[model samples]
Target: MSRTPDNWLLKVTGLTKIYGEPNENTLALTGPQFGSNICPETESIVACADINFELYPGEVLGIVGESGSGKSTVVKMLYFDIEKTYGEALLKPYANAGVNTLDESNQKKRYIRNHLMGMVYQNPRDGLNFNFTSGGNIAEKLIMAGNYHVGGIRERASELLVKTEVPVLRMDDRPSNFSGGMQQRVQISKAIANNPPLLFLDEVTTGLDVSVQAKVLDLIRELQHELGIAMIVVSHDLSVIRMLTDRTMVMKNGRIVESGLTDQILQDPQHAYSQLLVSSLL
Candidate 1:
């Protein structure tokens, strides 16, 4: 059956990834063996499989799953950090009506991934360069993405800092000097610097306190409403998903077990895993 397009800005179908099998023969000679059985030379494990989802413009799609359920892997594939083993990940451009499909062979896909998509990692430290000033870190992405003119770049970066609620006075300070919450705001500013059409937020508030998490979540909602940016938020926190997302997908062992409107899924979850997740939240 043909799938119906639901105002989708991004669509993923049957996505899968398997690692550590390509150089099995070479590894067999030098790699440590587990007893006489030789460890069977099995692949590491499938990080994700049969992953399918749709993200619409201005919609926050929450991907909630336990650790190792491939939530991060899905984000990596979307960001082109890793290649998918099978199936298609079609990113429909905001300006174009046609889908821009990606696979292992396309260099153009990488360019699009880097420019059109933005990612906020779980750890703010991973996303922001501690050595550089907060403004420099935010301006760096814009520069790399081809927004090279000094005047505009500086102005936009300063504006982004304001938008993300980071004080303009601290823009010259290194990320290491900022509080955790402030550093996270800097990271958010960096992610949104280019006004990307789609953004992947991988547990962006995991390490923050409740108040800070609330503030960050509110900022995300405000940005989404203002910019109409499509977002895929990978978070295990059910409350985060419920509060910020319009729709949600519940995953387990690299597969989606339940998906629907956020309220419906939370209020009347069908899958056992979904029920357990919801119960834990309550």
Candidate 2:
């Protein structure tokens, strides 16, 4: 893909993360035993290694992989929830401010999360505050972003609830009070509360039934098109990716094994892993 100087919304290069490195004493119940036969004595479990990808403005990049493929790890690193062991991540601003670099020391990632990036996790319960009402959750995000006016905050919350097709009447109810689908909608509302330039959706529809998943995917596509925001959708559901994303990247063992236009990848997969993934979807 040709990356324009101005069009790149996110850039990731040589990104890697290693956990439970040698010298630590973390133990496992049952696993292969190496030198010390201790979890911490083994070398790092490379969750992601030398990962490279770029997201352009208004594009949806689907990352498809099985369990332990590092999909969640990648998203977490992008959100700065976990510190990366190595590599660089840059976010291009929507206002032509140029690419801002993120790393362990610079802390630029935090700034991006606060103002430019948003995330929706696979489990809505994980993302939403159970104690807060749906409107309160959305309003909390706005307030955290520095908008303090009560009337304006409530108005925006109501508008977003409507945008996400969540009833305004349910706005005052806690997320725990809603059904799974409704809770997911509330999570989407909270994610877009700030109108972020980039969104990371980590299996947002994973546990929902097929019908509910379809509805949620449609809502995401509608929102993405309407807002012109860039998105990275990490999912194992090939059908969902095919329906929602512009392009797809197939990952295995912490590396991108194959990537191409969604249709092309589905029709003519280049890598063995991609072929297997595509075949399983069929």
Candidate 3:
């Protein structure tokens, strides 16, 4: 179910990120054509450039690339984890989509993050506070979204734990005490605590055991179906993209080489880099 231009949940245009001062030709000299993200003249890194996409409500979009390909940088910028060099991201639920979220004040960005979006990082430690118990983490998210009643917070936390297949009994335990897989499940529980419309998942199952990764992916699929949440999943693994995404963007050297429906990309990858990635799956 694709959305029309009139009803995109999130629209991003000219999304770019750079690590150092770059000259006008930085973007022009870098990317797939050069097989690098570095500018030879300025020695600056163009993390990603001219990224444009629209994610519809309940849609799952995949960004696939190898390490240092800037796939993670794109979402980090959108989620405000890292400041973008330049970009405009508009969310339908915020300011009627008239505002560029990247330019918003920090307080406003926090509000948007708490109420409109959620992010699950590759490392559970990045997303969860080790000092806080599982339930405490969820409570923090709920409180930020304005759910103040203690009883309500507890109940909601328990419910989220159950929804994410984490035992409610572990609610009082800190994530540091949980297994890697369990900690990730708890992270997912906390991420969706507010019922945000959009979620960003960065290599969510990258380090897990094969069986555990499958389980976590299944949990994510279940939650997306149950909550109708739109997601942007970033990963180097094409298999993960195949199982989870409706559409895919194949990226290399800080630029997207091709994009299309997931099935089509897998069956008929067009670009040389994309073909190499797809062949790796076989």
Q: In angstroms, give how far residue 76 of model 3 lies from its true place.
A: 0.2
For candidate 2, the TM-score is 0.88
Candidate no. 1 TM-score: 0.87
* Segments in model 1 whose C-alpha atoms lie over 4 Å from true places: 1-6, 21-43, 94-101, 104-110
Q: Can you tell me which runs of candidate 2 are displaced by over 4 Å?
A: 1-6, 22-43, 94-101, 104-108
The digit string of per-residue lDDT tens for model 1 on 134-190 reads 999988898878888888988998899999999898889999998888888899899
TM-score of 3: 0.99
Q: Which residue pairs collide in model 1, if any?
A: none
Q: Please report, as a residue range, the 10-residue window in candidate 2 with the lowest summed lDDT.
A: 29-38
Every model's TM-score: 0.87, 0.88, 0.99
lDDT of 3 by residue, 32-133 (tens): 989999999999999999999999999999999999899999999999999999989999999999999999999999999999999999999999999999
Query: What does candidate 2's lDDT look like per residue over 1-282, in tens digits?
Result: 355865677888888776766333433321222212224446557676677988888899999988887778988988877888877787767235344354334454555676788899999877889999999999888887889999999999999999999999988999998878889999999999999988999999888988988889899999998998889999988998999888998877666778889999999999887888889998
Candidate 1 lDDT score relative to the true structure? 0.80
Q: Residue 133 error for model 2, in Å?
A: 0.5
Q: In order, what lDDT does every prediction score?
A: 0.80, 0.81, 0.96
